[model samples]
Target: MLRFIRLIIYAIFSFAPLASAAQDAQLRRLDTIDDNRGWEAVGRLDVDGRGFCTGALIAPNLVLTAAHCLFDTDSKARIDHEKIEFLAGWRNGRATAYRWIKRAVVHPEYVYDGEVGAERVRNDVALLELHHPIRNTTVRPFDTNTRPREGAAVGVVSYARGRSDAPSLQEICHVMARQQGALVMSCDVDFGSSGAPIFSFVGGEPQIVSVVSAKATVNGQQVALGTQLEVPLEILRAELAAGNGYGSTAAGRVVAGSARRADGAKFIKP
Candidate 1:
């Protein structure tokens, strides 16, 4: 459980000076999105105004994010759908489009048991249906693609803890390993990075191949964990189409507000 630590710490002590310098060079902040026209589809998801996670526009009215974001970390209950908001292309306190969540669907296999493992991470995918579709010409939804092979070049765009106000792009990261429906990548990520999209550049167009679920140590180096989206994403889409995956808001269960571990990162779900 303690084996996976968010890669943010690597900036301070995990790498040799030369390697750290190289990493710093690759991960850059997307301060003003006007300069990063390609990343306007990724946005911040404010969950019930209590916490936030990164998400990306996948369709006119659908947003892709991590399954855990829909539940209260402390209560382990499904958060009220009405409380969630999607700030598309959010940056510097402004958003290209803002909309409320109407319904959400998590992978049927996803369980919020507060565990961290390959299976849990692999199934950590979710989709949100917005009350209104984002038809902005500048903020088009991203296209999804099948998972890339091991050692393939990948990239990530995310907004995390300290950099919560703006998104950052790690334009050059490598898929370090692929095992049991999860991809271990040498990407820099942190607490709020969960649900951020992992992209593969195919035909010079960025396509989402995975979603950040957790961070871990691989061979003594920090790496981000993501769900291989092919199958899980299809299952979630089907569930949503059938109108069966929305979480119940009933009041009987114990509702922990938000589960935060001793480490800065939150607990991995399912």
Candidate 2:
């Protein structure tokens, strides 16, 4: 089968050995207030009004997602940060909190254009600074954890293409393997699922262990891939802290910049 990062969703790559199957939980809709409570931080990222991806708030004003979501699907160019919006706790027809991105940064090692290999997969993460912090009582931002071990059970919450109106949670999926700093899990994912937070409920609280990068097939069984999170997350955080690797926004216009490289980077055109 062909292996390439599909622009709409997955960027396929080779895998290590697949672990024995673990019974994964089915997707459950977080439609009601009770079910969606404590998960309001997970939101849908509408990229330039053209497509959307899943993201979650790591801080009051910081949102984490796949770096690929910030780029143009066809042109392979960085999308204007102004055009991106975070619909927090989006359910039914309305969102609990609507926020705009002020600036954003991707992992320094990430390349928006590529074959989406293991190298890209391991670094496919981005962070966005919201113009306003989400301080809703129901929407609490999540914490991060190091990558789980092989065979560790993980969960995923996301807004996919078909389930764009609300988020769905798959409570149990096993880490199939760890390949060159990338993780292969049995979690269910699809289009618009990129950047979804992969959680590990180690102490009865969901901590983000990884961020969904792509969906792939492993030995005839479907699997999802993610970055290891620790190193990449630290890298992104440092970039944001240093006042670099960001594109700014105001009044529906982007202050020309790039998130990939300090030099020879593609600047967003007005």
Candidate 3:
């Protein structure tokens, strides 16, 4: 996985570094309610009690994250969705809202092959439907936007390994390059940052442009890699609408919330 990630970074390094002035933003913890305002939708995803990744609410009940987060890190087998939980706005050991994933749908092209590459990163997106909708006064879902261009300014908020108590915000980061459908940015991200949303503040509103997929180094400079959300996001949404993902009832049950259904337990299309 590490080697393949390096390869992806290397291939895009010629255009990977942004201006030094645009690369110094640091992660600031959003530990207080005031500090966490407008970002209550970003959450920590607990997958099957084994490990965690970052996720964010995109709708009343739909949580967006990386597809790889649902697979076991060791055996590469799919993890049971029943044990997964979404802790929105987690801070001081608590969350603004807690909900269990009723079902999840990964991008049709994503696969957890224990390796990473630009192609793999391009398709690394998923959507999990919560058992109940989160309609809070403060915890509002964010809107999605088109892919960002190189050198575009963006920001990210996420819960990582050492900063798991609350999600930290990297207020300013530059998109370094776009290779195929993958994006390389100068954002600070680590393991738990996977599925963390990358936001573009156009028109004074935050819209999701990408999600952290992997971290890599190019010429000793670290960078965050992610997928361009415009296409894969729609794909996952369509899959969920078709009732092809795992539903809230059981492992094999699939429901499009109120309409469609499937007869299998598999969440990812084989």
Candidate 4:
């Protein structure tokens, strides 16, 4: 079987990776704006009073995020669905509306390793079923076809601990990997940043390529990695299509973006 990159990047910036440019500067700004527009809050047990973990509304009723972000490492237990609510356009603990989670579907093959190790951390994507359909919002979908090239500009949108008011963005790594198993970027993130979305320019549009998963170091340098979205798209299609009179009571427009790099690192088109 063909393999997709497994490392899911996180929001925390570690002291491992050793480290960009003006082109890097502009992309960083775009990521900050997109971060605010796309992020949602996922409340769970492990999270403190301010519920941690972030997700994005990819469909009328489905929210996409990191599987590990919602569960325990050893028990493999899920966060209480009742306590789990999605805050749309979430910022300063508010939203246009909030939707309670009826169910959370973690990828079957997902294995957790107590926030460390390589294998279990690789497959970390999750889908949350909301109780109500989002209103008048253009949900962005992930693009699995294209991957950002080496040295290509990239951006990320996510909610971290200190920066809770809005998602922050910055210029980070270009796509780095020699094969299909892993793609690395240079964005620095932190703990609450888990499940943050990775986006890259494709066709002049920002498309989500993967989700923030874990942070690691290379040659004593810190670097974060994320699981590619393609790993869970097939499973997600099945879950979303399993509709059972939940969500999607109204029609909504759709938008597309990714974490992959654009042709020459240009700001995303509106």
The per-model lDDT (C-alpha) reads 0.77, 0.81, 0.81, 0.52
Provide TM-scores for the models. 0.83, 0.88, 0.88, 0.67
Task: Please state the error at residue 8 of candidate 1 in Å.
Answer: 18
- The TM-score that candidate 3 achieves is 0.88
lDDT of 3 by residue, 1-93 (tens): 567666766665555454442654888999898999999999888665466788999999999999888888678888877668888998877
Q: What is the lDDT of residue 45 in candidate 4?
A: 16
RMSD (Å) of each candidate, 1 decimal: 7.3, 7.1, 7.1, 10.8
- How do the residues 12-37 of candidate 1 rate in per-residue lDDT, one tens digit apiece? 22442212212322678887656668
**Superior by TM-score: candidate 2 or candidate 4:** 2
**Backbone-clash count (model 1):** 7
Ranking by lDDT: 2, 3, 1, 4
